[model samples]
Target: MSALLVAVLLVPALGAAVIALFPRGRDHAARVTGTIFAAVTLIPIAVLPFARDDGWTTYSATPTALRPWTEFDVSWVPALRLDFHLGVDGVSYPLVALTGLLTVLCCAYTIGKVPSGGQGRTLVALLLVLEAGILGTFLALDLILFFLFFEVVLLPMYAVIIGWGGDDRRRAARKFVLYTLFGSVLLLLGVITVAVNAGTGDLAQLTGGTGLSRSTQLAAFALFAVAFAVKAPLWPLHTWLPDAHTQAPTVGSVILAGVLLKMGTYGLIRIGVGVAPLGAEWAAPLLGILAVAAILAGSLICLRQTELKRLIAYSSVGHMGFVLLGIATLTATGLQAALLGNVAHGLITGLLFFLAGAIKDRAHTGELADLGGLRESAPRLAGLLGFAAIASLGLPGLAGFWGEAFAVVAAVERGGGLWLTLAVLAAIGGALTAAYFLRLLRKVTHGPTGSASVPAGIGGAEWFAWSPLAALTLAVGLAPTLVLAATSAPVRALTEALR
Candidate 1:
C-alpha cells in the first residue's frame, strides 16, 4: 500500500518529464503520451480498494514533511519545534482519487480539442505538474508541506490560463493569481502561527490539540477560515472564479471545477475544523451566515449571467455554499453531506464545463443570446447539455440531489431557531439554482433557434470529450453508493475527531 501511494505521486511527474522531452511537433504523439501516462497513473489508485485500511499508522515522518512521494521529517526551526512531516490518511483519500480522475479526464479531453500548435508539450507538462500539486495538497499531512503543494498549483494554472485561454486571458489570469496569492499569504501566517503556538507542525499532533486556550483557537480559526473561504470562493470572495473560468481553456476549466476548488473545503476539514473543534463550534454561526450569503449571492449571479462558462462558474459558488453550510452545522450528517457534495459537485460541474466548451466550439461563442436552435441541429450535444444542466439543478435521483438535500436536512435538524432560518435560506438557494438552469435551458436549447449562424451539433472531438463525463454522471446518479462508500470510512473518522 505504501509503495502504491508512492507511485501515485510519482508517475505523473515522470510521465510529464518524458512528454516534455519528446518532439513538440508531434501532436498525435503528445496525445498518446498524455493518455497513456494518465492511465498508468491510475494503476496505484485502482489498487487502493484491495489495500486494507492500515488505520492510523504512525511514523517518525521524514524531512520531506507532508510533500507527497517525499516523506521527510526534521526539526526545521528548533526553537519553534516545527518538524517537517507528511503522509496521507483516510480523510485525504477521496480527494486524492478525485484529483487523479480529473487529471486523466481533462488530459483525455484536451487532445485535438485545443489548437495543435506552439508549446503543446509544455502545456501537457504543466497540466501534469498541476496534477501532482493537487494530489499532494490532498495527501499532505504536514502544514508546511501542505502549503507548498497548495501554493504550487498557482503557477501551472496561470500558464494554462495565459498560454491557452481565451480573449482577455492575461487579465483573467492576473486576477486569479492575485486573489489566490493574497489568500495564500494569510494561509501561510495562519499555518506558521499554529506551528509556533502548538510547538509542532504535525497535523496528528495538532489534531490532539496542544492544549491551546479557546481564545487562541478562535484566532487561529479565523485566519485559517479566511484563507480557505477565498479558495472556496465563498460569496464576494468568488469574483475571480467566473473571470478565470470564462477565459480559461476547456481542460483548465474542467480541472478548476473538478478538483482545485475542493482544496479550500478540504483544508477547512483538515485544518480549521480538525485542529480547532472548539473554535469551529464558536464560529459555526458566523460561518453559516457567510455560507448562506454565498448561496444566495451565487445563485442570483448565475441567473443574471449571459455567458455559458461564467454562469457555470457562478453556479459552482452556489454549490460550494452547500458544502460550507454543511460544515458549519458541525454534525456528522452535515460533514458527510459536505464530503458527498464535494465529489458530487466535482463530477457534475466538470461535465457541465466539458459540455459548455463543446457548445462554444460549435457556436464560436458561449453567450446565451448568441446561441439558439441547436437541438434540431445537434441532438446529441443538446441532449447531453440538457442532462448535465438538469443534474446541476439538483434533479431527483441524480448525483447532485443528495448533497444539497442532506446539507439542508442536517442544517435544519442540528441548528435550532435562527439556524433553521439560515437552512431555509439555503433551501431558497436550491430553488434559485433550479430557476437559472431552467432559464439556461429556455435560452440555449429550448427557445426558437436564435440565429442561423449557430453551428450544427457536436463532432468527434466534442463527443469523445463529453461522453465519459455523461456516463459517469448517470452512473453516480443512479447508484451514488459507489462514491459514497469510498467516502464513508473517512467521513466517519473525521466526524469522530470532532467528538
Candidate 2:
C-alpha cells in the first residue's frame, strides 16, 4: 500500500518528465501520453480504500486521534527537523480522488482542444506537473513536504495561463504569481515558526497544536489565514481570480477551479485549524463575517458580470464562501459540509467551465450579450449547460444543494445571535446565487440564437470529459451520504481535538 501511494505521487512526475523528453510537434503523442498517465494515476486512489485494514467502510466508522492511513515517513532534513511524510485519511482521500478524476477529465479535454500558442508537449507536461503538485499537497503529512508540493504548482500554472490564455493572459498570470507568491512567503514563515516552536515539521507529530503557546498559535494562524485567503481568494483578496479564469484556456480553467482552489480551504482544515485549534477558535467569528461577505459580494458581482467565464469565476467566490462558513462553525456537521462543498464545487464548477469553454469555442466570445437561445441551435450543449447551471445554483437533487444547505444548517445550529446572522446572510447569498444563475440562463440559453455560429452538438471528446462530472453531480446530489459519510468520522475527530 505504501509503495502504491508512492507510485501515485510519482506517476505524474514521471509522466511530466517523459512528456518533456518528447520532441516538439509530437502533439498527438503528448496528448495520448498525458491522458494515459493521468488515467493511470487514478488506480492507486481507487485501490486505497480497499487496501486499508477496515476497507471502504472504515471511513464511516469513528475516527481516532490524528492518525493517518497508509503513512510513508522518512528522514529528509535532520537539521531542520523535516521529513518526507505523506499519508491520507478519510478527510484527504475524497479530495485526492477528486483531483485524480478532474485531471483525467482535463487531459481528455486537451486532446481535442489544445490551446493556441501552447505547444502540446509543454502544455501536457505542465498539466502533469500541476496534477502532481495538487495530489502531493493532499497527501503530504510533513509541513515542509506540503509547502514544497504547494509551491510546485505555481510556475506551471503561470506558464499555462500566460502561454495559452487570452488577450490579457500575461497581466493575469503576473497578478496570479504576485498574489500567490506573497501568500506562499507567508505560508513558509508560518510553517517555519511552527516547526521551530514544535521542534519538528512532521504534521502527524504536531496534530494536537504542537504544544505551542497561545500567542504563537495566534500569529501562525493569522499568517496561514491570510496566505490561504489569498489562494482561496477570499473576498478583498480575490481580484486576480476572475481575470485568470477568463484568460485561461478551458483545461486550465477546469483544473484551476476544480482542484487548485481547494488547496487553500483544505489547508485551513488540515494545517491552520489542525495545527492551531486555539487560533481557529479565536478567529472563527472574523472568518464567518468575511465568509458571508464574500458570499454576498460574489453573488452581487455575478449579477452584473457580462462575460460567461467571469460570472462563473465570481460564482466560485460565493460557493467557496459557503465552504468557509462551514469551516468557521467548527462543528462536525460544519466540517462535513465544508468537505462536501469542496468536492461539489469541484465537480459542478469544473463542468460549468467546460460548458463555458464550449460556448466560447463555438461563439468566439464569452459575452452574454452576444450569446442567446443556445438551446435553439445547440440543444444538447444547452441542455448540459442548463443542468450544470442549475446544479451550481443549489437546486435540490443536485451535488450543489447539500453543501450550501448544510452549511447554513450548521451555522444555524451554532445558535449565537452573530452566527444566526451569518446564517441568514448565507441563506440570502444562496438565493442570490439562484438569481444570478437564473438570469444567466435567461440571457444566454433562451430567447433567439445569437449571431455566433453554433458548432455541432457536444462532441465525443467533450461527452467523455463531461459525463463523469455530470453523473457524479447527480449521484452525490441524490445520495449525499456518499461523500458525507466519508468525511463525517474524520471531521468528528478533528472537532473533538479542537474541543
Which of the numbered candidates is closest to the native, going by highest TM-score? Answer: 2
Distance from true location, Cα of 375 in model 1, Å: 0.8
Misplaced by over 4 Å in model 2 are: 53-64
For all candidates, what are the clash counts? 11, 0
Clashes of 1: 11
- Candidate 2: tens digits of C-alpha lDDT, residues 210-310: 56889988999999999999998798799999999999999999999999999999999999988888899999999999999999999999999999999
**Candidate 1 lDDT tens digits, 185-237:** 98998888777777667876677345566777788888889899888878778
Q: Supply the global lDDT for candidate 2.
A: 0.90
Provide the TM-score for each candidate, comma-separated. Answer: 0.92, 0.97
lDDT of 2 at 457: 64
- Each prediction's whole-model lDDT (CA): 0.80, 0.90
